[model samples]
Target: MSITVYPARRILTMNPSQPEATHIAVDGDRVLAVGEVDTMPRGDGCVWDERFADKVIMPGFVEGHSHALEGAMWDYLYLGYFPRHDADGKQWSGLKSVEQVQERLREHAACLPAGEPLIAWGFDPVYFEGTRLTRRELDEAVCDRPLVVMHASFHVMTVNTPMLERAGILDGPRVEGIMCDEQGIPSGELQEMAAMFVVFDALGHNLFEKVSSPHVLRRYGAIAAAAGVTTITDLYNPMSDEAIDAMVEVTRSVDYPVRLVPAMGVLQWSAEEGIARLQAALPRSHERLHFGLAKLMTDGSIQGYTARLKWPGYHDGHANGLWNAAPEVLTELVQAYHQAGLQLHIHTNGDEAVELMLDAIDQALTLWPRADHRHTLQHCQVIDHAQLRRAARLGVCLNMFANHLYYWGDIHYQRTLGPSRCQRLEPLASARRLSIPVAIHSDAPVTPLGPLFTAWCAVNRRTASGRQLGEHEAVSVGEALEMITLGAAWTLGLDDKIGSLDVGKYADMAVLDQDPLQVAPAELRDIKVHATVLGGRVHGGD
Candidate 1:
């Protein structure tokens, strides 16, 4: 065996019985052994790759749930989402008021091409106080150019006169979601799925063709490698077979440091056709490329104020949210995929959606019981104790949207669910108690994929205001680390081959500037990755 040794100050294998190791030996793509550095096995043919004498080595992070298309979209965008002062920066990402948005848009419109649509993202009106931008304000922002600023939640949008005229919104059989006043004039805000679709389709955002390019894939891969992530579960848009083909082609063309597990979209397929499609795609299923997790979106986000709730609705009492799939429809779909031996990773951010999905899974399991089924619920932002029990009983895995506590935790506490319900968001401790395997995700573009930041959220449960929402729900740094590392691997059904620095496992490891477990929880976000090793080869070293 052509072996190599990696020695570090501390190596976190994440193996339960023996969690920490100082040395790791690799034989090509697989780990040969892990143990104390001094006592590590030595041989005549072995090569040593010692690194980061003051740094920590851990298994590369695995994203249990994420939208790779969205990641690629951000890669293709001008990336003015985060305000970094630049003359060319045309983003209105975190504008505080309607006036600020107007000023920014007015400036951007002056420099844009005449006919090209001025597309802007990351506009959450909730954080901008109760002020909702109207069509007049958008029209004032850009006089004649088509302008559509999407709400960060992706459920709501604000369109200008040009877009409204182009979409034929002027005189259509009143769509299901275009919010309007008593006079029937199109309000600035488009709420729910119906109106969201009109604007999205009208924007001509061909997600697959727009985002799936060699440039985008390489950029995204570089981002992942920089953050010490070696594998990602791309919660895919099922309708885009072309995107899938492009992703496969890209991974093959380059020595990708990160492995991709693409959870194919199942929303477009019937129970029968879905099975046929999955069977057709099985030949693509292998170690580093294809996976069998079927993705289903069951509801919108909490930030959108469209998340289905249990009791008194939102604190503001605006809307009670919408469901992505009817309970009966979801039940039939889950049953078909379950019976076909495909793992289901459903996106549910609302308690009502969680309850609805649990019921579907319960019914499906009753019809076809399988202990190792490993069905998953992605972004389980609002699961309660009862629902947690149901998930445990149904053998469903919970991919907790831990990033919510950072991005939307404040809004959830103050506006979305109120302080009481927000306190129970992402019940990780409860999940652990119920013996349900839980993993955390970045949801990226939605939030950046920083495993350290994800660990900080899980460990501190603190919001932007520095207030701890669910201190009891906080996990140990080790446990939080595991959620992104080993736990995430298990969530992706790649535990047998990845997730830990154990023998026979892939040599996917990360070198950190410091040991996260030893650092203060508050300093977790400041942790930087020094280097990454994937399949026994270094991706890039600092």
Candidate 2:
């Protein structure tokens, strides 16, 4: 294999004592050496690439848990919660009231030719507390124009009158989640997967057939490369065989700019059915696409006040939240999959839901005794210290929604779980103390898929209200970076092959404008991707 040396001011291999190096030697798609310029051995007399003279090279950022296709789908549809500064610019996600939403809607609607669905995402009702915009509010915002405002939760959305009428949901069966008036008329709020499926079904065929076309998938890949992400665990792909084929074609077409680890979105499936579905997909493993695990959204989100919390949820005196699936249903699913030699990635945002998962995992272990399975529990948001200890014992990996601290920390502290349970949120420190392998995730579309910001959130734990929730739970900047790289790779069972820039590891790396460890915590989010190299090929940035 011909070799090329990449010389940088600093290289963060994330290899503990020797975290920083001066150069990295690449032979084919693997790193041959990472050390000082003089000590590096040349691959057959190949010279240095000399392209990264002044930049900081780090192991490419990996988003352990995210909805890649869904995030792309959101980009394909409505403007993000963040402002769309222009026709195409960095979007703004913070809007204060219904008036602002209407203004943005008018701007987007005016740009369209006519009759196009005015879809907008990332509008969280909790953000505009005391003034929750109902379906009636959305109707007035875009009169005669079809509109659908997806909640930041992505687990729910509030559709306008036109959208409701189009889907025939206005007078449909009284689904417990769809917002309704005292008269039992549809109110616009569509909560959980059941209600959202109504809108998704109405949209016609799956997005795989349209938005994620070859042309669009290329653009999405470009976006990932530009963002400095080399690996992402897609949390909510439709899991259809067609979707997998599209992704595989995209990856093989020109070497995917980022490696995709797709988790089959498993809902309403028995363990047997889930395994059968994986077999049906018949995905062939490649350097870029790995479809081995299953994603289970077992509970609703906390922001919508639908998470299955313990007794006293929502500081505002709301009772226990709701569950997406019953305990019996989840237990059977976990057991069947565990017995089938498949990995289970369950999404549990509430403490009660976390408890149920722990119980279910314990039962599965009893029936199918096999160690090192490394089944993961995602979105462990409202879990307790005790839960962390339990997770450590069971070898259940955790992919924490660390971005929750920045996006919903204040709401959770003041409204959702109150001050008492707030300190235990994320609990990375407790997880570290217990020797648990914890990974961080954006759960994008829930939070944008920005690994640096997620790392910052894990390290700082700063709330939207500018208050620190629990300083003790904060992780170091190094630890935060690893949570998305090495730790995340371990969770995906790709550590030996992908994580750090070590000898024999794949030459998957990113060049950032600045070293995250050298910058202020707040500035971490501001750093931009200078370049990204995957499998020794430069695909994005300068």
Candidate 3:
């Protein structure tokens, strides 16, 4: 048997029994023991690796609500408001105004052949004051070719005239999300699924829906390695045969950098088919791809005006938002999946959506009576004290999009929920106060994929405008770290296998330049991740 020992400056195991350590012993991919170097009780032919001796080691981050597409999207044009670095270490500057967005699109469109379909993502009009990007503005950049831009939230799409002409939605029926002007012309602004599908069908790219291309997993892995994440979720995959085959191959490979837990999208298949499809893949399941969970997108994004919020709706009084499934149908779906023994992680950004989710899961559990359901409500953003208590009672975990405070906090404070409700937006403290198991996430590509940044946002609760979004909701740095580690693992239902560093668990570690607990909360996002150790195999080390 092969054995290796890694010595670090300090090890934050996240294991309550032996929380701190200086050395970790690995037997193949699993941890054999963790303790100090001089006193490590080891026998025979064990290799001692001290490369990380100068760096602090913590349990590898467990990101519960990110998509693999964050990696794949880099191949396309990036127009995100926040500066992002691709897997290749190429940094793209953030776009502030529509003028800069148009300039960037024009420059990128100049190189592409005509009619090639200039596709760009990470565009949001929420940050701007006066006017948002419309089809008219997009036409100025590339008139002849079909230009389709996906909003940063993925809930809205802005397409040029060519796109509308190709899709035949220009004169088509008055869809719910399609905007028409005084002249009765379609405004080229499509919101939510009903309208976005028109553009999706024309473009023929599954950028938003069912993106499981192999390149996605590669880039996602690269990003994970850089951020010191060991296991990540492709939270809402469509589970096509091609995608599953690719996932199986890549995950089964011994050198796969990060582990993946892809929840099959319920919308992609019938309830029976969804269960059977995953059941079919169950025999082939490995340590890397744990197919224990499935995803159900309850509603849309708040900033995109698609989230289903209650009472006084949007500050602008737009609309209530779209429900992917009715309460009864959602209840039936959850019941079927829960009865079949698959964990369901529903996407609910709004409190009303959360209410529907609470009802659905409650009905399912009441009917099936299964314990340890760990059915998570992903991006449970606008939750309240009562909802947190109800969630705890129902045994439903909350994987909050804590990054919302930074990504859309200012806008939400000023526009959507206004100050009173906005200040209470992701009640992390309320969840903890109620003794509910809560894990924080980036929901990457929605926000970026850095857990430290997610934790920083949780600890600081500061928005881009430097306003304290919810001082009452702020958590301590240690608690925030737990949210990213074991708490996240529990939300994913992989707590027993991964999460904390322990004997018999996989030896995954994130080597950091500085200790997160010792550093100021503001500097948490600034602290660099030197390398990641997955299953005792070192990746991204100098």
Q: Best candidate per TM-score, number?
A: 3
Cα-based lDDT for every prediction: 0.77, 0.79, 0.86
lDDT of 2 at 506: 87
**Candidate 2 residue pairs in clash (backbone atoms < 3 Å):** 78-119, 81-93, 82-92, 82-93, 83-92
Candidate 1 residues 1-542, lDDT tens each? 67788778999998886799888888889888889877676779787876566779899988777656544555222222344221222442556567777888777777777877887666777776757777888887786778877666666778887888778786765666677867988876777656666766777774434445656666667778888999876775553566566667777744777887877667666778777876776676555676567887777888887778888888877778776667678777878888888888888888888888888888878888888888889887878898999888878899998989977788888887888887788999889988899999888656666778888899988887778888788888888888998888888888988888888898998889988887887898899899888888787775
Best by lDDT: 3
Decoy 2 TM-score against native:
0.94
Sorted by lDDT (best first), the order is: 3, 2, 1
Q: Candidate 1: TM-score?
A: 0.93
Model 3: per-residue Cα lDDT over 1-542, one tens digit each: 76888888899989999989999888888988888878665667788887999899998999999988787777779888888887688889999888899999999998998669888999988888768778899998879899988888888889999899988988766667887878989888888776887677777876755356666787788788789899999988878888788888888877888999988888767899999997887776788888767898878999988899978788877778887766677778888999999889999998889988898888888888988888999887788777888898998899999999988999998888899897688899888988889999998888889999999999999998899988989999989999999999998888888888899999888999999989988999998999998998889879
TM-score of every model? Answer: 0.93, 0.94, 0.97
**How would you encode candidate 2's per-residue C-alpha lDDT over 1-542 as one tens digit per residue?**
67889899899998775788999988888898899989687545787777788889999878788765443554534434444332245556556778877887877778877777877777778877787677888877787777887777877788889989888887665555787789878888888877777777787734323434555556556666767888877666666656777778887865668888878777745566768978665457788878788877778888878788876656788656666667788877888888888888898998889999999999889888878888998888878877888999999999899988888888888888888778878999889888898899888656666788888888889987688888889999889889988999989888888879998988989898798889998888788889899989887655
TM-score of 3: 0.97
Off by over 4 Å in 2: 70-88, 110-115, 205-212, 268-270, 280-283
Model 2 CA RMSD to the hidden true structure, in angstroms: 2.4
Candidate 1: C-alpha lDDT: 0.77
